[model samples]
Structure formats: C-alpha cells, structure tokens
Target: MNPSPPLAPGLPVLGNALRMMGDVQQFLVDTYRQMGPVYRVRALNQAFVIMAGERANRFLLERGDEVFSSEVSFGGLNSEFGMRVHVLRGRPHRHLRKVLATGLSRDLLAARWDDVTAATERELAQWRGQRALPVVDRCQRLAAAQLSVAFTGANSAARFATLRSAFELVLDVTIAGKWPAAALKLPAYRRARAEILAFARSCLAERAAHPTGGPADLLDRANEAKDENGNPYPLEVRAGMALQGYFAGINTVAYLYSFMMYALARHPDVRARVLAEVDAAYDGDRLDFERLRGLPALHGLVLETLRVYPPAPGSARTVLEDFDFEGFRIERGKRVLVATSVPHQLAEHFPEPELFDIDRDFAAGRRASVYAPFSVGSHTCLGAGMTEVLAVATVAMMVRRLTVTAPDRPLRITATPGPNPGRRFAVTVAGRPKI
Candidate 1:
C-alpha cells in the first residue's frame, strides 16, 4: 500500500499556526520545499492537507462540486458573512449566482461608470497635498465611500465611516480565528456588525416600499431577485446577502486598488507606460467603460498586480469523498488548500517570477494554469468581471491626473489575513506635471 502523504512537522500544540500567522505565503512555500507537493499541517487543532504548484491549484479549484465543497471548506465564513451567495454550495450556489449575475453583469457596471469614475476622482483630489498617507488605509476609506453609495445608497460622509468600520472589523474577526476572534468580542466590532445589519435592514425596507424605481444599487438588484422556484428570498436573507456583498465589494476592491497603486509607485517604467496609455485613451473630458478598456497599460498593471499579490493568496475546499492525489490516498473531511501565490510564483510558469513585468502576454492560454487571482470553476468570484472593469477604471482615473511616489524605504507586501501593503507603505500623490 502506498504510504500516506507527508505531514509537516511543527511545534507541539501550536503546530504550524504560528508560522502561518507570521508569513502565510512564505510558510507554505517552505513547507512545500521541505515536504513535496502534498503535505499536512495542523493548525489550531485542525489538520489541512496542502497542495502546491499549478497542477495542484488546478485540481483543487476545478474539481467537480460533488467531490469538493466550498461551503465546508470556508465554514468559518457563514458565521460572519451568513449563508449569502458567496458561501452557498451546490444548487443553491448556482441559483444564487445566476440571480446575482444580473447585478454583477458588465452592463450594470457600464451603466454605473459615471458614478464610480466621479467617486474615484473625488478621492484622488483628496489625496493631493497630502504629505504621506498609508495607501491601504486611504484606499479602504475611498473604496468604502465609493461602494457604500454605489451598493447601499448610503452617500452620507458619516455612513462611509460606519460602513468602512463594519467591513474592516469583520475582516479582522475573520483573521483572528474563530475562537480568539469570538473571545475578544470587541464591543466596537459588535457595534459595527449591528450597524451593518441595521443599515441592511433599512435598505430592504426602502426597497420594499418603492418596489419600482430607485438607484441601481446592490439592494435594488437583490430585491428584484427570484430563486429557481420563482420564490422571493426572505427580507432578512436579502439584507444579509446585500450586506455580504457590501463587505466583499468594499474590502476586496480596497486591497486590489491599493496593490495596483503600490505597483505603479514601485515600478517607474511601468508607471510611465500606464500614464502614457491613460493619456492616449482619454481625449474626452468624460470617462466611460470604453475609454477605460482602451487603457492597456493600466489593464496590464492590474493583472500583474493580481498575479504578484492576489488579495487572497489561497483557497480551500473540504473533501467530501475519498480521492487519489498524486499516488497519495486522501481521506474525506480533510481540508485541501490550494496555494494560489505559489503557482503564480512558479518558475515553470512565470519566468523571472520575482520581477514585476507589466507587459507579459496575458491573452495567451498561459494564464489558465498559472494565474487565478479569482479562483475558478463553479465557485469562482461572482464579481470577477465587474471587478476587472472597476479596477481598470479606478486606476486609470488616478494615473491620468496624479503621480504617486513610494516612500524611500522599499514598500513591503504582507498579509493582514489578505495581501496588503504593510504599515510602512505610504505613498505621496501629487498632480502630474502638465506636458
């Protein structure tokens, strides 16, 4: 009989949790080097069999839903995000995704272009004359302000802070692990969650009263949704679902926007290319989706940033059935981790993987196995298409008018449970010199 897959040895009781906490991507890479592609690591009393490299990522992300389950893998999410569409599995997931497609579709994004562009312009204007500001912090606030209005019709300045706080606290809770995160049970986090729920509740009530015309926010779309059985979801579920979308939209977009900005600051040659493309793409005073797509430099910058530092570096799926993986007999109930960061960095796929090359040919099929910032298959990110458009537009808006410079110290990229610019990464944004 073939021996079981190797288990990564770690300190007693603590297991690999400490290393994982210290540096998730590096720890995974080290473990892979020491124990081959398949290995198990115990963390916080749970064991996870990690699969590394392109093939492993493909298998874990693309396998049949009958065998692997996202709901089980990310069980921690339901407690926080509720059983929203992102956490749904099987038929429920499929149906919800279909319903959400209407909201997240490209057409909806195109229609909302003016507001999103205007929001980014305002934030960029605010950034000017700043001495030094943490890119992540500013980006999160800007993203929250933009999305809160776009997603929930909360356009008040006060509402932006509340929404931003709620999303950030929830993300912090997710990072701190369930028990400790629960134990601490900070009142601020509690208050934020309550506010989020309340806000969601208000949106639902308003949607119900109108039931016809209003801003094309997320709640509006969700309010109009019907399940496969032609039944409307409960008000609470719709609220929860809309809240989850707000949390996801605000948080993930903040990270993506920050990373793209950070990349432009750190890489001057690439920055020049992006500025050139932005200038050439927009001669008109008004910006639109078509104008945004005309920016190949900014588009490539977004893709390269995602490849280098995906907001979420890894994805997990809990095995529901016994399966054979590379000669090793894996058992059910075990969580399978697919390292997205590792595959993106693999020398086999990306030559000189360490270098930040913005001009790489992403159109070719090479990205299929090597790049998956949004994961793949049935559980792929519902906002994938919209996210691409938003990222491009936001970056273009900034690069078109401003020049961002990184601090003298090399900007550090670390994960605050997700890839983020470390505390010291502050960039100075100033108006571009007129040419």
Candidate 2:
C-alpha cells in the first residue's frame, strides 16, 4: 500500500486538533493558504486527507458512490446511532431518498404554507411585550413550531423546550469528537438517545393510529409510503428519519433567520429593499407560497447568508478503495474532509465573495451545482424545499411586522462547531408605522 501523505506538522498525538477546535473555519483557511487545496492533517491519531476548492467538493459530494461512500465517512454515526438513514448508502440509500422526496416536493410544500405562516404569527405574538429577547432562542422556537406542525401536526410551543433539548443532545453527541467517548458511553448519552427515540416512536404510533392520506404531514406520509419491494420502513428507521429531519430543519433555519434580522438591523438600505420587496410581493398581508417564490431578492438574500455562514462548515468522506485524483493516490479507509468554507468563497465561482450582495446572479436556474448549502447528490438534504420556505417566511414576516435595530455593540457571532450563533442578538422590534 502506498504510504499516506504527511500532515502539516503538529504537536505529538493531538496533532492540529486543538487549533481546529479553536476555530474550524479559520483553521481550514490557514491550511488552504499554507498547503494548497489538498493536504493531510492528523486528529486523534488518525491521518485524514483534507481537500478544498470547487473541484474537490464536487468530487467528494458527487462521486461518493464510485470512489467514496458516506457509509465509510460517517462510520462513527452508525457505531453510535446504529445504522440510521444518515448512514445508509447504495440502493437502500436511493430508495430512502425517493420516499423522502415524494413528501418534500414543491407542490406539497406550497400546500403546507398556511401551517407555516400560522405558526410563525403565533410565535411572534409572544415576543410583543418582551425586551432583550434572545433572538437565537426566539428563532429556534419559531422554526421548531413550524417543523412540528409540518412533521406531526402538533402544537410545538408546549413541547418546544423538550424537543429542543432532545435535538441538542443528539447534536452534541454527534460532534463530540474522539475525546468524549467515555461520556457518550455513560448513561447520559444513552438517556438522551432514548428520549429522542421514544419521542419518535410515540409520533410514529400516533401517525399509524390515524393514517390521514389526503394532504397529511411528513410522518403521516411516511407511514403510508412503501418501498418497491413491498417492505414498509421499520419503526426504528422511521424514528431515525424523523430525528434526522428535525435536526436538519431546525438549527440552520433558526440561525439564518437571526442572521437576516441582524443584517436588516445593521444595513438600512438592505432592510428597506427587503421590506419593499415584501410589500410588493404580498401587498402587506399574509405571505402565500406563490408570492414568496416570486420574490427573487428574498431568495438571493437567504442564499447569500448560507454562502457566508453554512450550517455545516465541512463534510467528510472515507475512501472505500484506492482512488487517484489529479495524480495523488488516496489510500483506502482514510478519512477525507472537504472544508466547504473557503470553496464557497472562491473568486472563480463567486466574484467578490466577501461582499454580501444579494443581487449577485447566483444562477439562472435553481440547480446551481456549485452552491451546495443543502449539499448535492444522493445524500443531499431531504428537507431542502421545506427549509427554504421556512426561512423565507420567517424573514419576510419579521421585515413586515417590526422594525429591527441592532444592539449598541457590534453583533458578536459565537461560532459553535455548527453554524449556530453562539451569542444571541437583542433586537428592538417596534410596531410598523402605517404606510
């Protein structure tokens, strides 16, 4: 076997793990600057080949089946969570994605707009009399409420705290790295896992008991769906899917919403433009799905937010077999992480990548392969359409309902490992004056 490439030097066994822990994005940018697109890095005594740049990202996301596989990359997930949908690949993978796509199509999403709008309005009403509300927390609750309505037709405000806790537990476990194995092995991890699974099971049971065929939520639809082989998805599989769906939908939507509000507060010009677009699109009333879709500037703003602060900064793929890319041999079984941060900011793909210009023509059609906030290929995010709708609605509602002003200090973005904002902003929202 060809020897693995050398990593940029680091201390002892820990390697560059400490630096990565401090700030993953900046660490990656530094690495790319030093070693170019493809280099090696060591973490937890494991040597991983790191790749960046547009071509590298394309190869990692698109060529997973032939050259690499998510199964290999996300092995830790299976070992911890026991072969959930996120770890499935090959034919089984294709089947699961198809079933998910059926429920998340554009028409189905359009049909569900009323549920989303109602939930958003309900949540916003609670924030009316409060000062110094944690914007991140508020956005999270709003997104969770909308997701609950879409996922299970349940009222989320009462259960938001529990659901949010469960979701955070799962996320914490997944991103713990190798050091937290002891803690994860303890009853805490197991208990959290049990809580999430138990919640899913109850939801599945309820959906099974009342199987609504016409315009039902995600759970109801999944309960009705069956594979070509006539096999219904197992309860565990369904639960896993539900858990993953909530995780995918809630965190990113909330963060993007907060960022949009922050941008509106800071940039009056952009705020005025967004407000004008919302007014023209909806005539200062409820946001219909069709109207939201027609607002191109709103769409551009959300995309730009994602480009600057992707929910998941990097993605990993493990080589299933020896593959040669541009003359470098990637050995089998070695993990390869593609830092998506720098590539999305590449000048070749996005001109003046630093500037937050929503009007930049990202692409003529929706299928901008290079713009991968939802990722691409088989493992692409199943809830992309739903997420986009939720974000657009949340931003539009805030723009229409209140005038947001930033705090006295510049907004401090707490860069958690995920794209979550660490420090919540306190926005002062006054009632919109009559136009």
lDDT of 2 at 150: 64
Over the stretch 1-435, how does candidate 1's per-residue lDDT look in tens digits? 455688899999888877776557778767877887888888776678888777776676567476776765454455654546655677878898777666556665566666766777887899987778778778877776666555555544566677666555555454435245563277876777677678777877787787646446577767777776889887666776676554676667888888788777778899888877777777576665777767777778888888877766667777888887777877888777777567667667778878998777665424465677776567767776677777888887787778887765655556554667665667787887874
TM-score of 1: 0.90
Every model's Cα RMSD, please? 2.7, 3.0
What are the TM-scores, per candidate, against the unseen true structure?
Answer: 0.90, 0.88
Poorest 10 consecutive residues of model 1 by lDDT? 175-184
> For residues 1-435, what per-residue lDDT tens digits would candidate 2 score against the true structure?
444454687778888877665556567767877877777987665667887766676676567677666665455555544335567778877887777666555565566668767888888877765667788888888888877666666655665665665455444545425444465566755776677668777877877887756575667656666655778776666665555555456777788788777766766777778888888877546676778778777887888777766665677677788976644678888787767556667677778887788887656312445566666566667776677776877788877777666675655554453555455567776767765
How accurate locally, in lDDT, is each candidate?
A: 0.71, 0.68
- Spell out the clash pairs found in candidate 2: none
Off by over 4 Å in 1: 9-14, 44-46, 81-83, 152-157, 168-181, 184-187, 211-217, 365-367
